[model samples]
Target: MLEEDANAGYRRLFDDDGLTFGAGFPLTGTNRSTPPIEEELRLASHAESVGFDGLWARDVPTYWPKFGDAGQTFDPWVWLSQVAAHTDEVALGTASIVLTLRHPIHVAKSAASIDRLSDGRLVLGVASGDRDPEFPAFDVDRNERGQQFRERFEAIQALWREEYPELEGEWGRLEGDLDIVPKPTAETIPMLPTGQARQSREWIAEHGDGWLFYHLPERTLEDYVADWRDDAGEKPYAMAIRVDLADDPTAEPEPMHLGYRAGVEWYRDYFRRLEEYGVDHVIVGLESEDPEEALSRFGDEIIEV
Candidate 1:
């Protein structure tokens, strides 16, 4: 069986033949700039109440004016822990933590801590650095991000699975002398690599517990899923989409950044198609003036289908 098939977080949020849904954080309408984040906890709890399988938080360590987006506007670790306290039974995920910029030890410790705190509900999505300015700011070599990402991933796994693990790489050197505390609730925390992370498709298929990808057209997504199944049998495939659900139930789809602006009826059909295409989960970034109403409507109409 695939690691995702066995992971507690994955088990809670996905099934073999059907699709589950998660709401991205900074649930408020604010994007493009720093979100106030005042209502995130309340909205997250509501998402769980409405049967959302997971609540995703993004890791944006610094604001990049050029990038034009501030992901959740809080430290992912601190924010996730706070959100964990307010909700029950909802999987808490980091859409991705930039592994190449941070030390592997910290990522391991923090992820394990969240996993334990959430009672094995942590799904850690990791990535290589993306924002160009961030690499130089953190003093990380942009060209070496791929190598650093791989090394960090390996180091994190060893720390979680072995006691006093001895690891040597660019991240650091660990000689079986020191052990990282608070190992994941299970043998290891589920790690889903986001995007390519500058790694080969084969590498991701072999190493990741699951694959988290950006939104794609139906045919494109179907092809990607087929390739993934061929390479990594039975592992889950997840994607993120930005949606602006219209008030009219029969409104047709119009193109948006990563998704579409459509009605609840249209979304229901769209999501059913996604399920048929073997998408295991979707992390939806909702764009709405009244986010609460949109979320409730999506849960009642789309997710229940």
Candidate 2:
């Protein structure tokens, strides 16, 4: 298979020798059940002003109380479009949209629209549904999510790259009699699959434009990057880390959920290590009393170093 080159968003965010950073939405450390959405645009612009490369939005179609996280509390498409209007250079991304829950056609259309609106700065991270109750709520069979995920993935690709391409599978069929309009700014928008999405590593390596995974320890990250390189060649590798920045610049590393509670000095060294291990980009879920201060600190202290 011929691999597509990185889109503008990917190129801006990933380089051969260094790592780039992006901030996750709901930049404030607000309650999980009710994110402070009013702060998003201001912080998004602030992130760009401070030299962050991208801003990511989470796609939670429906909030499950049991899940305990509201994930930005807005539709990914609408949120990204709004973000795009307020910022010029920063890449806009979906941390991972639940592809299994949405129709592929809708995903394709919305993705393309965002790509055009943002002038090709959209990076789509997609995943199979992770919330169990969501499947029943959406009237989709949870058991077939793997198959549905594969089908939707292929369908979106076909819709983007082919002119009236013939496609047939679980999601439905495109018989080449019709076509989806407003193609992406590039040949296609970048699509990074999150955490295997029930597919084999081989499959993800073969199909995904890149790979997005949760935070792992240094040794595990090295192994994961090695395996990805062996199977996928030079595709980008990205991950998310939950960070609680301490006031002291030289604070020691401490464990947190999927990341660490550390200070700028530790974070700088940590990111340097990630760059050495071939991580291309990182999405940071920042924890701070004042998100603006945190974003400014990260850009000035860690990213500029």
Candidate 3:
């Protein structure tokens, strides 16, 4: 069976027969700054009610002027745990968690706890991180991001899948005497590496349960899907796109950063093409004045139609 078929969280977000969609958090679509969250919990519940398959949270350890934005202005674990409480059934994803800044011990424990709390609904997206200032702030050498990312990933897997597994790495030692509590509801939680993750494509194909990538043009996406199929077979592939939806359903698509400002008619076509090209899931970050209405419009016009 495919990984998506095997893992509950993975299955929630991906299916072999057709594509699925997820709502990116900070669902209000505020960029380059923190957005208010008075309605976030309600919106999360609303998203699930409207047929979204997943809800994604981002990992932003600290705010930096250079950083694009504060991701939901909350820690991913706390936010997802809260989201898991208010909503059920939607896959709870980390858009990703920066491995270099966190110890795998913590990640493993948190993931296991959350998976058990949410009943195997956690799908982890791990990344090497791209912010320059965060490196020095965390006292980690920028040069060692890739190595740390790999080591932490392995450590987390060991903790998740094995009992008292022996391991020694830059993080610390697990000397075959101690164990992390709260293993996932499944055999192990799903781990999807985001972006290149400072690792080779072959490495990701070998280790990742799935891959989370940025938006790409249709021509590029087709080639990406083809390459992914060749390397990873049917392992699920998911991508993120920022959308500025228009009021008029018949309006044509106009290019925007990492996505399009298009009407619902064009929206339908784009999603169909994505599915045809073998993309498994699309994480849509909606940019709009009234995000709640946009969410309804997207669900009514694109997903339900």
lDDT of 2 by residue, 1-305 (tens): 22356567877776435788999887875536566566778898999999889899989988788888888888989989999999997889898999999999999999999999998889999999799988999999998989999999989988999998899988788888998978898888888999979999999998898899999989999999999989988788999999988988889999988899998889888998898888889999888888899999888998887
- Give the Cα-based TM-score of candidate 3 against the true structure: 0.96
- The residue pairs in collision within model 1 are none
Query: Every model's Cα RMSD, please?
Result: 1.5, 1.7, 1.4
* lDDT scores in order: 0.87, 0.88, 0.88
For each candidate in turn, the TM-score is 0.96, 0.96, 0.96
Model 1 misplaced regions, further than 4 Å: 2-7, 32-34
lDDT of 1 by residue, 143-250 (tens): 998899999998999999999998999877999999999998889988889999999989998999889999998899999999988997878889999999887889
Quality of model 1 by C-alpha lDDT? 0.87
Off by over 4 Å in 3: 31-34
Clashing pairs in 2: none
lDDT at 178, model 3: 97
